[model samples]
Target: MHIPELYCPIPSSVVVKDPEAGEELIRWGADQGFFSLDSDAANLVRAIDIPLWTALAHPMLKSADDRSFLNRWWTWGAVFEMRFDTNAGQELDGFFEKFMDSTARTQIRILSNNPPLRDGEDFSEPMDRTLVSLLRETEQRFGNPWRSRISRSLLASAESGVWEARANYLSQTPDFDLYQGLRRHSYGQTYITDCAMMAMGIDAEAKFLRHPVIEHIQYLVALYGGFVNDLNSLDRDLYANNRCSSVIAYRHQYGVTLDEAIRAVVDMCNGYLRSVLAIEAAMPDYGKYSFDDQEADQIDSFFYILKMLMRGNIDWYEVSPRYNGGWKPGGPIDPAPWG
Candidate 1:
């Protein structure tokens, strides 16, 4: 399972303050099968004391559905771990429950709809029963949380927007420019809201959303994360016929080889990283926003956490089965070390 070339070593600057936290994180990953790697999966586990990562464990343990919990954590927990503190994590756990419940309600509502049929054709047949059966099974497997009708509508609308964005991209012809492609590709749920919550912890929504600089930070972080993914997912995306890649877009626009396209992407990512770092350095003294002392400190912590997150993406990419030659159906895609 090892790929020396794919490996992105953890930097000393992006560190975990507590050894126990690091061990628990690694253990949790193993228990959850976060990667298709064996016990000696340290390379797959990057150490960043993201308090939010720790916070999720409590809810996860209490969850009736381990798979659903694992899916959520496996998807975002790796990235979240790099930047958040303990209090931030706790705050996020509360938000995570709300967000997941909202998402589930949205999903349920979508599934509840009847599929459009041709004129003069009734869908009240065996398939309709089958669909209802499937829906019931899904509901039973994953219990629904109480969500207000207004909350459901809002979440559904948000989900619809993402669906529209993706559909719009797929409907378009190829040969999109880098910006267009990045916007389309990077526009999915990247937990930008949750990231901001790291600073505010509780009641963080209004402050983070209202702040002018936050949008810029969000855009940069999304682009940075998106580019990192586009770079790592070159092969998988190509194989899966997902061509909305920034690197591929660059190649189409410039007529370069894949390697050259990769280099170009790497350079762009590094540039974004530098920009974020510069922002981190300058944010403290900027004094434009009416940030209270606590808010200011949180913002500073966020920037630092962001750096680790961006870098940790590179590290996680190297080891995640999702990127490595590890994903396969109906089997342990990669064998454990003992085997």
Candidate 2:
């Protein structure tokens, strides 16, 4: 689904000026049926510009020696940029800075609040300091001083209570078993972390959707998206991370091969797509200017683009890889049955 041309009637001009006020406005918009929780979630997801930019900016990830990986990363950024609202793009630069700072502060506080898990152990202090320093260094390297500041503040504020809640949620529920599985899988861990951060951003911004139901939906979408991307990059992820994805983990435990594993992952992703489609359909009708239609179209366009890429009809530079890793165009292959 290519992103639809529908303009979100909610004024970007007003929202972009102040994030707190913008969040309130988003909630109001949702209540009035001008938007859905998913759309609001999408906006929060878009705000994590740093991670996306990091994937683009990091030399290790974007080596000129590996043109395919660099090109694919660029393509992914382009697609996201194409779909992102212009105002949202402008707001994100600042929002990302504040967000990073917030997360950094929170991480620091959490580390300080927790005691060592073992005798004569005190890795938390040094690890927290190292992460803070790394965050600063990353921002400096990227020329984002504000991001560094915000990251420091964010991590400092994230204390034991928050950590405990997150830990409890991950440990206590079958609902979050997929997340735990992802955490256990090396390649899948990035998705879990990214989704957790995205969910936090949404909660921090729009307070109304902080409920478990909303968080669970966001987690599901993120997990399934990760599954799809992992299936698409199975060979690359294995080579780069020396670990298979959660889907592969499940397969190994149950005894399945590459092809069978791919099918299972695809089926799971398709189920997520169906759920997304249903949510988009249920959104209140907004005459000819429907946000639901716009969302549905974007989903359709993404699948269409995936189809084209699978068929090798799209230029390698035109379709981007969603996750980090190197790629070799037409290296070793299985002809996709979807083609």
Query: Per-residue lDDT for 40 in model 2?
Result: 34
Candidate 2 local lDDT, 205-309, one digit each (tens)? 333234353345444554554455455545543343313254455555557775675666666666654664454454345213433343444333332322222
Model 2 worst lDDT run, 10 consecutive residues: 7-16
How do the residues 1-339 of candidate 1 rate in per-residue lDDT, one tens digit apiece? 111232223252333223354455555555444443343233334322233332321221322343233333333333222111111212443443463355333333434443422344433332233323333443343323211221233233334333323432343323535344334223232443232232223233436535777657755766777666666655544444444566667777788887787777777777776776677677667744566765666666555456555655565545445455563322242211100
Alpha-carbon RMSD, candidate 2 = 18.3
- Candidate 1: where are CA atoms >4 Å away? 1-189, 192-203, 206-209, 288-290, 325-339
Q: Candidate 2's error at 316, in angstroms?
A: 10
- On the 0 to 100 scale, the lDDT of residue 43 in model 2 is 46
In order, candidate lDDTs are 0.43, 0.34
Tell me the TM-score of each prediction against the true structure: 0.51, 0.36
* RMSD (Å) per prediction: 13.4, 18.3
